[model samples]
Target: MRKWTGGMLILALATVLFLSYNFIGKEPHKQTAYDFFHPSNTSLAMGSSSHAKSQQRIREKPHLIDVQGLDDLYLSLNMSEEESRSLLVWAQMRPLLSRSDALPDTVEGIKEAATAWKELLSVVSDTRNISDDDPGWKDCPHTVTSFNGNLSSNGNILHIPCGLIEDSSITVIGIPDAKQGSFQIQLQSSQVLGEAIPNVILNYAVHLPGDNVTDEPAVIQNTWSNDLGWGKEEICPDHRSNHSIKVDGFVKCNALVIRSSTEVNVNVSHPVNHQSTNNISVGSGHMSVNFPFVEGNAFTATLWAGVEGFHMTVNGRHETSFAYREKFEPWMVNDVKLEGGLQLMSALAKGLPYSGYLTSVLDIEHLKAPPVLKKRILMFIGVFSTGNNFERRMALRRSWMQYDAVRSGNVAVRFFIGLHKNLQVNLELWKEAQAFGDIQLMPFVDYYSLLSLKTISICIMGTKILSAKYVMKTDDDAFVRIDVIISNLKGMVPDGLLYGLISFESSPQRENDNKWYISSEEWAHDSYPPWAHGPGYIISRDIAKFIVQGHQQRDLQFFKLEDVAVGIWVEQFKKQGRKVQYISDEKFYNAGCETNYTLAHYQNPRMVLCLWETLQKEHEPNCCE
Candidate 1:
């Protein structure tokens, strides 16, 4: 009886011991306020994620830190360290115009703030051209990004999804600290400016040390949601508050805790409830400056940690630096934490300076072009039309487009249409599409703002499916000198093809009443990259492929203006080491046709008839002259 009892006791003890070991060692799964948006704080979920895929490559995010008081930093760096520090202080505080007495809350003050922001942005944007020695100078790789964050590992490399990472906020990337000197990270922010108000902080727990100082980070990232105003209680808990006072929900403090590097914008905001602490002591590093923030502006911020401290630059401007808070250690910091509104486009944790390349195959549209055809000077004219614009479509077909050659197997001409909200209009468009087979209607509405999307579909059809050597995107109101254009196509090269009235460095219209009012929300940049004027532009097959691929990768930001969007693609290709040969000659007139005209814009039916008849009578003279 005693022996049996003893055996039972031992077994029970063993079972209890096993249970205790498992229970005591594991951490509980707790969701905090920060975790709702920032999943990077948690263990990386190995399988499928509920979040949508990542949309950026290493460099699509543009726009960087505000250059407030860096006047001498540019024109001349001859200023003393005291002068430099003073300027830096002023630059840091300019964005806090919402709070500072220097910037009173009034229309004049707001206008002044806006102007200051514009000037600061100008410095950051143009600094690269100033000199290689200037901080923040970087050559934009400027290609489309295709790796949406849904990743799969194939033993050797990790594969991501096939869309843009538009919705993702934090992308926590862990870097292997193999060497002590390893400390360089380069990434481009997406071009989408999240909120019109530039009040937010994009915090980076730059050097997340895996040390004995509690694994829980000292601060949660301030993901000031547009829905939630900037409130101090959540982002920087009471335990985290130090310098800036929280007015309403906006949190402001002028101090630094040297944990890492990332741009933090001080803008109008919202709130949350949390604890705070002020245990760490670091002096003189204050937060200031807010520049015009635009989403989808591809800005690059590169952080390099040296033996002294963390040195940083944004798009080639030497932005800021921070010395070691505690001390630099190889085994200390291993991962990067990105918090806030940014679509974390690229994260490079390589401590050593290294090079990497991105190659993508992005195509998403189908056109029923001839599968097999002998080599010919083929060209397709995709005229953007509307359901209500039936008159315009018929007028075009009966006028200049009536050329029998356009109906040939070698050259395909089609009208691209979009659905109207009215069912009758939609049904009529579908019927038209089925009957003519020349009308390609899309699933989207026929709104003028979404022309860029329509253009994407056309390029896909022209380049990937049609196999055309040349394609032209013209408006329904334009008349093309097709007979002359074909003659010129014979001598054109197979690549680097672009022909249009080029627009160079056009300024964004700030006047709201104007048809072209480009709010900072739409595009934050002062001037746009040189783009071809929209009414008509000729693209070679290769250029078409590049443009569509870039858009698919979400590298090309979609603007309301279709021509400007295409121009953005052209600029991106230029950054990618490809060049578009644009013919800015007045003969490729953006307005009504000149006597020597390859194309005529805003042509009515009468104008089209006149143009076709006149060109034919000219004995095939060079219209390009």
Candidate 2:
């Protein structure tokens, strides 16, 4: 038809210009004010009730500038210069139009306020030719005024003020400047002390003593005051802010201004009895001092007065003397009785000052003695009593072997008795001398001749008493040092062999009862024989008569650990060629406690009273006087 009606009128004019450009670029429908004060849109524009009384008279208008004085110029800095030339002549009579423009409801609003007063005089002549410094002039004289108005033809409203000057020269306009880079400055005030004191003073003085009291002048009183409040006519004993002073009932006083500071210190707290009355003096009115009686009763003074670059006046005073007097005594040991060992040998001769020949061999009258022993040694102590304190273990083994054989002038001790309910002269529980002694009480002896006569009567009285050239045996809590065991065995083995302490093995079958067990199958025949354990054993005297003539044809038996039955009779006298030696040089168990042993064993009675107080305090001399 006419080219399809011009292609259907160009597709209906491109769908009506794309629906009018998507309805004018969408994004707007947000009306509410209750849909513009709906009463159904005021009754659909109220069939015109005078257009709903002119829209409720423009929503009851009446806000004529009162934006709550725009939060008082945040922090003013006193501005001025005639309120900055009347806010640059009110922003040069404002008028850059466009605030929906319609405010000229009159004489063209005076040509839009004369073209905003020529553009606020070209922004105050470009803020006075900007060369910096001039944050609106500050030398205090505040100002910050602003104003805007249009309110109709599309709203507008601003107005800030904050201008000050007043001291009655009147200016004051404060309150305004609702933020957005606002300004103002100036502040000052603080000094306190009732504005630096002008009236408050006090001073006093007093002294009395022409050899004791009364010369009149002495009643100085103003007890106390702090932050002022009492006596001396409501504060004034020299501005009574009392620092301290109290003098009551006296016996000592020579001079006293009791309280007047600038610099003073007199403290002598009592202790000098020459019949009381001391002295002190200062002047500017009554003086005559002599303070010196310090024996006991009480004294104190410290004054540091004032006036010199201001403030300083301390005072503390006190003086009491109830007629002083003191005397006491009693403690004298007549200059250290007996010159206490000549003052510990003159403090070890001035700390060891012996220059040569050991100072004549430490002169104890040129010492000489210890070195003499021509045989005569016999120490034997063997007690195996079977319980109930056998006569308190034979009177503690005959009083410590007659006090170590009369303090070792060649020892000689003996005791070989073991009666634990007899086991037939216990000779080694027989079984060909059950390899020797009651091998740990053979299953607790149910009598086998009471373990063969207590093991062949202790192996024939321990080989006829360890045959003596130096025999020891032991056990009454063995403790023998008979002069360091006969002076270390006549000075280190002076003839033949035999010392003691040998324990190759025999800790009683790691003991833990089987009546004090001892079973490695009764020491499974020989594994450690060179022995020594019979509560401290020692020998020599011809190996104690060859073990008492080899226990006269062995038969009696009973060990019960007599040092592993004397190490199986010294391993059967070393297969009869006689040689049982293993004395790792003496020191047999100080199982007692403290030691350096020449011999020791069970020791008790508190280790013989701590080895008789560690040998009378290690060799007498006022042994712990």
Candidate 3:
């Protein structure tokens, strides 16, 4: 019994071993799973209907071929045979197969079987080649051409020629499937021709200088013979590019020369018909020549002569000679001699054929006339007063008053009064008003009164009451050049008008004291009209009368600063349609001791005295001498 049981076990084990070896060693049947699951295969099919459904699902609804992956698969299939083969091999080798160890004979079957083998070899190769220097060869040409196979480094569609493989037979073995689409290609070349040159046409016009004759057009023609032939247009396109066309010729006058033994001053007149209206002077020669040619223009010539009597010939033609027997009168020449001489030349050259070296001469006289003279007078003189003291100011005043009494001159002068006395008076008033609770009114009243008094005093005394053309009022300490002031005023502004040193308003600040302030009531107006400051300024005769008359109507009040008061009064007059002109050049109260100032104010007494002396020596030298 034991032996029989052991034999059965041994036979069963041997049978299992034989079946396993055959299954492992034999090539897989060429039939795919679909053949076994087909509805027509009944012997091996149990639940064949269900199996058919499973096979349909695997073929028609493949889960492995998702939308994204199917796109790549389709693109691979559409590639060239070599490219398709390469892709299929790469995809198959990416994942190992369970059943096949050897490749298949058919293209599709071979690709499927080779996938597992290729994947294994690729893993081993990648692992062996990996190193610190290359980091697994991330930027390898294989991968770059795979995913971005159609794109260049600059992100443009790449156009690769199959012919390039002849030189370098490199192939990308593994790659991501390419996107499927219709691609466009554009080819271009890199050579160009230069721009063509253009044709140019030049037009020219000519004129004669110092002659009022209108130019007459002259046609210049050139004809070339076959022997001296000009080249064709193509050969000499720019033939006249730098060539100049010059017209040169001469005009002749049949003039007669007069000769005498003594220095007989003779005047010869041509008949009206043969007269050359253009005048030419005779200077100890057979003919007086005049060349009337402009630069690049036409030329003309005139002829005359001075002598007692002489014969003249033009181009080998003879003219009659004359003799001066009586004393010559320049106004009345011998008409019979003149007519005979002109007629002889006209008859000789009436139709004669001649050219080259044409010359002529005529008798003429040098007539002398008396010289004429022109006179100039002092049309206008502007006076500006200088000197500070009441006596000196009066002297200037009296001198001007007398000068006006004689010549009625226009004058303007200014006076400089120190602000110390006014400031002292203002302080006293402020102290007095403070005791009465009127301190706020003190500053306004003192400043307003002080300004009004200074301006009104000048208007009354400094200007001519009625006769002056213009009057300028300026400070006594100012250095002024009356001549320069008059000349500049005559050139720039000639009218009798008031002028001033102008100022524009900027930020308001008081440097005298922190307590000083200006109320809104003081500068309520949006803008101040232009007016002259009293330090140095001008007043026209008409406006001077208005200001003087305005003061007469009421007693003039005082203001601390004369300029501000003048601005206020001028503003009043401006409202009445009278305007003040601002003079920017005439600097007023320029704060320098040695500058060439038009006017300098508030200077030291010693400097002012020295300036007066220097100006008298420099400008009034005649008076000092």
Top-scoring candidate (lDDT):
1
Q: Quick one: ranking by lDDT, best first?
A: 1, 2, 3
lDDT of 1 by residue, 12-120 (tens): 9999888866743334355421222123432433336675444322222222234333232234344344323212212222222222111111223233224433343
Global lDDT of model 2: 0.30
TM per prediction? 0.40, 0.17, 0.28
TM-score of 3: 0.28
RMSD, one per candidate, in order: 29.6, 52.9, 52.9
On residues 270-325, what C-alpha lDDT tens digit does candidate 2 reach at each position?
A: 11321111123323332223321111212222111111101111122332211100
Q: CA lDDT of 302 in candidate 1?
A: 56
Candidate 3, residue 379: how far the Cα is off, in Å? 15
Candidate closest to the true structure, highest TM-score:
1
Computed on alpha carbons, the lDDT of every model, listed in order, comes to: 0.45, 0.30, 0.29
